[model samples]
Target chain A: MSILVIAEHDNAELKGATLNTIAAAKAVGGDIDVLVAGSGCGAVAEAAAKVEGVSKVLVADNAAYEHQLAENVAKLVGDLGKNYSHIMAPATTTGKNMLPRAAALLDVQPISDIIAVESPDTFKRPIYAGNVIATVQSSDAIKVASVRTTAFDPVAAEGGSAAVETVDIVDDAAVSKFVGEELAESDRPELTAARVVISGGRGMQNGENFEMLNKVADKLGAAVGASRAAVDAGFVPNDMQVGQTGKIVAPDLYIAVGISGAIQHLAGMKDSKVIVAINKDEEAPIFSVADYGLVADLFDAVPELEAKL
Target chain B: MKVLVAVKRVVDYNVKVRPKADGSDVDIANVKMSINPFCEIAVEEAVRLKEKGVVSEIVAVSMGPKQCQEQIRTALALGADRGIQVETDAELQPLAVAKCLKAIVEKEEPQLVILGKQSIDGDNNQTGQMLAALTGMGQGTFASEVNVEEGSVKVTREIDGGLQTVELQLPAVVTTDLRLNEPRYASLPNIMKAKKKPLDVTNPDELGVDIAPRTKTLKVEPPAERQAGIKVGDVAELVEKLKNEAKVI
Candidate 1:
């Protein structure tokens, strides 16, 4: 059996999630090939070729795929779907946008956000806002799935020597056009890819208080995130939300500051290796999952925590 | 131009869900049922479009058990011109749901189709994109902002890194995110009027779509509960525990 792993990258470097997804692809036990589809992405393909255990790297660089438009990228991936038994991508926004469309075009069902590889066709995934974990078995001939990057360890990026093959480009249907992007410019790592995440809640009160978390984050080299409540309250943008309905992050360390630890919020980061909750309320649900709990106002505790770090 | 909105009936977001004893599904019996929160946002966006006179009419569609009509009525109360119910008690997968929506799209030919990014229950997050593929339409998934133009729609999407903007031709599929718009509550008078609104009922068989479960759910079990830990006296103790015991720092 062969596996086709879709690589996620900016023009320069591959996202850490893609390496983690390669780990998942390794678990499926196959001759794995990584596909780097982008415009002017030779450097990305070069980086993907060095990922350990990858046998081949297929590069589809074309102007039509410049912005990774779902309409265009899905067609490119679907056209290449027939060669592999299992096709996988990380459960990022780009993967979520493109995989289902490709699966539908292939007349197959797409298994989403698989956290565990039970067999080749059976997988475990979260359902009901992560309240329940469901084991799903796909009976289709081709298994299409998106790996929850946090569930797997990233493959080493420096060890492998795989050949990179350039493939013919697919024509853009011109049904949709990319109208530019507005990305949050941050020096810290992204929330999902960060080793440590510092998340604030409604208790932070306003966007101004988030600066305190940023100070702590900078000290710890962590990414800053917010609860859905904080996002709803406009304390931060929706892109920074970490919850059941938002981005699910499983970092090595998660520190919740003044967050009430709603079930929705817990679903996002409960899988962290270590959790620390600092809330004024002793009865907050966050304490239940925290390895270390501090019952103090975040205004005081966060500053002291930053100083100590 | 016409707008089509899809809504789903799910357990109210406030209710804490538990798995059944047999590990089949969540024990949703007697739980408060409501429209999926993101679907409500989609319905609200459609109603706002009709109010702006950009769309001539708004048709709400749902595919679920008979009781889902309650949600259809709720959409009507929110301002959909009519409702279509594809009645089925069997649990439908995302692909099947997309196929059913494709059948409806073939007949209605709405210039714009809106659906929630994912249902709160299954959280599959596939229907809208699959529908777009099955029907050969452009897609704008996870849209935070949407603007309809003469022959196309511009959508600003909330993605992982930040936000992305895209433009799709008319008759495209747009899936909503939470930040789209606040859904309005159905007033009492509008609720009463919704009871008089036209609701057409049909089934998957009638639409010539096969609604089959593509993936079998082997088991449903609650996640491992985390034991409550001791509260630290201050940040120093917390840092000590994180360093010595957890060793994750």
Candidate 2:
């Protein structure tokens, strides 16, 4: 059996989530091939070739793949589906959009956001907003899945060298057109890929108060995140939300400031290596998962921590 | 133009559910049920469109046991012109749900089909995309903002890095995200009026679709619980643990 990992990347560089997806592919135990489907993404393919355990990297460069549109990319993966036993990608928005369409085209069932691989056919995944974990077994010939990248440790970016192969691009589907994109600009690391993240909640009161988190985060060189409460309260943008309905992160160190730690929020960051929760309310659920709990006003603790650091 | 919206009934988000002792499935014996949050957003977006005069009619659909009719009625109370219940006692997978929705689409011939990105119960995030592929229509998933224009629609999607805007031709599929809109509650009068709204019931077999589950649940289990750690008396001790033991800083 062979595995095909769809590499998540921009035309210039690969995203960090792809490395953890490669780890999941390695766990599946097979000759893993990485597919880089994007316009002018040869650099990404070159980087994929250096990743440990990858046997080959396939690069499909064409204008049709510039934005990684689902209709076009799904067709690209579906037409090449016969070569591999398992096709997986990081459970990002792009992967979620493209893989299911490919699965439908292949006439197979696609498993979503799998956290563990018990066997080639059976896998473990979270359901009902991570309240229950379900073990599911697929009976289809081709197993299609999206790996929750936070659950797996990322493979090394360099070690062994794999060969690169250029492949032909699929036909463009003229159904949808990419109008434009608006990405959040940040000097700090991406939220999901950060080593240390300091997050604020509704207790921040307003958007200006997030500057407190930004200050401490800057001192520690960490990412700034927010709970769904903060985002809903207009204290931060929706992209910064960390929860079951939002982006999941498992950084090495996570500091929760003024966050009550709702169940939905815990589902996203409870897996961090070391968690420090500073909330005024000792009864906050965030304390349950935290390694170091401090019952202090975030208003005082944050600035003090920033000055100390 | 007409809009077809798909809603799902699931356990309320506030409830902390757990797997049964035998590892068979989640125990949902007596839990408060509500519309999937994302589905609520979908319903709200469609209703807004109808109120804007862009949509002439709104048809809501749900696939589940007879109890799901309550959710369909909820959709009606929210502003759906009518409702269709694809009644089935058996649990259906994403593909089966897509096939069933496709059959309804063929008969209703709505210009736009809107659905939640994924239900909170399964989190599969596939039915809308699969239904789009099955019906040979364009799809814009994870929509944060939707705008209806002449013969097409523009959707601003929430991707990993940021927001991406795409324009799809008519007769397309669009899924809702949390940031799309705040769902309004059904007023007492609207709830009363919804009781008289037309809601038709049918089965998957009648729709020429199979409702059998594609994936089997081998087992269900609770995730490993995190143990509560000791509280640090002061910042000095917290900093000490981070530097000496955790070494994260």
Candidate 3:
């Protein structure tokens, strides 16, 4: 089977999630083609060509796609994906924004986020905020799905030598225009790609209290996250939220501080290889999944832990 | 300008859903049901726009079994001027639902359409974008802030790295994110008034949209449980375990 895997990238570099999506595409057992659609994204296409298991890289470079607006990108994917057996993209904000629109253009029902590929036709995904896993089989002629990058191990980034081809498909649906963006400046790491992540919850109390977690995170070179409660309490921005409705992260080590271990929070981080929970309440549900549970006040233990590390 | 908002009825956010013993699907029988939280935010945004006089009328829509009308009523109480229910018993996938919404958009000719970014139950996160595709409208998904202008709307979207602002022409689609706004509670008098609001029921057949399942559920199962591990006595011991045993650090 031939699979079209959309590469998640900005104009300059490819995101790590695309490699994980390529891994998922490998699991589907197909000749994979990576689509890098953006303005001045030749570097991204070259990087995609180096990814292991990719057979070809298709670059659609144009001003209309510079911002990767869903209006233009979805039309591009829909028109080009007609030749493929399966179309997949990483379940990031960009993927979530455009893939379904493309699927509708194809008159196919697209699967949201698949964690496992049981087969080419059947896949497993989380429903009800990861409380239940559902195995669904598609009967449509073409299968469209979004891969949960955290569920799959990333493929090697620099091994393959695929041919890069430039496609001259320019879809400038003038319905939308790019204004601007405000990206968070961070020195540590991207939360989803980080090897280690330390997150805080409502017990962090205020935005300033995230400093404690930041100190610990800095020691470990880890990314800092927060629970939905913390974000809802206005202690942190919504981008820092780790929960069913927010970002899903799976690191080598996940540390939860002052979080009550709500099911929604667990849904995002339960896939971590090792979990550590630090809370004052021993009865917090977080203890149920933590590999190492520390029943202590985070205010004292976090500082002490940073010093010890 | 008129606004079209879509709402969904699903199991309450607090309810821990479990699959049936036969693995057919999630058992929602007799479970507490409520409007999906993100959809509530969409309703609130529409009400706020109406309160600002940028929107002349609000049309709330939902598609499901008969009971979905409760969610429509909730939207009315929140501030929608009218309600429409595309009643159906067939499984409503995102594509089919988008098609139905597209049909309504054609007839109503609303200037703006809003929906939750994702439903709590299915969590598909597809309807708004797909509707935009089918209707040939611009889309702004995961919107944290929305500003309706003279001929277009500016939306601040919550992307992976940070926030992005985009301007969409008139008759655009927007999906609500978590930080959009806090939804206000419906009072008793509003609930009574909502019961009298115009809620017209139409079927998928009437809209000329085919509601069919393109996928089949092979099974439903619980995620592998993570076994609880040992509790550390102090911070020093915890660090030692990580360096010596786990080696994660």
Candidate 3 per-residue lDDT, tens place, B58-95, comes to 99999999999999999999999999999998899888
Q: Which stretches of candidate 1 lie over 4 Å from their true place?
A: none
lDDT of 1 by residue, A1-309 (tens): 899999998877888888989999989888999999899999999999999999999999998888888888888888898889999999999999999999998888899999999999999999888899999999888999999988898999989999999989775978999998999999999899899999999999999999999999999899999999999998899999998888899888999998999999999999988889999999999999998899999999999999998
Give the clashing residue pairs of candidate 1, or none: none
Candidate 1 CAPRI classification by DockQ? high
Model 2 iRMSD vs. native = 1.0
Worst 10 residues of 1 chain A by lDDT: A166-175
Which candidate should be chosen as best, given lDDT against the real structure?
A: 3
**lDDT minimum window of 10 residues, candidate 3 chain B:** B216-225
In terms of lDDT, model 1 sits at: 0.92
> Which is the winner by lDDT between candidate 1 and candidate 3?
3
Question: Model 3, which residues run further than 4 Å from truth?
Answer: none
In model 3, how large is the Cα lDDT of residue B163? 98
Query: What is the Å distance of residue B51 in model 2 from its true position?
Result: 0.7
lDDT score, candidate 2, position A7: 94
Candidates 1 and 2 compared: the better one by DockQ is 1
TM-score, chain B, predicted structure 3: 0.99
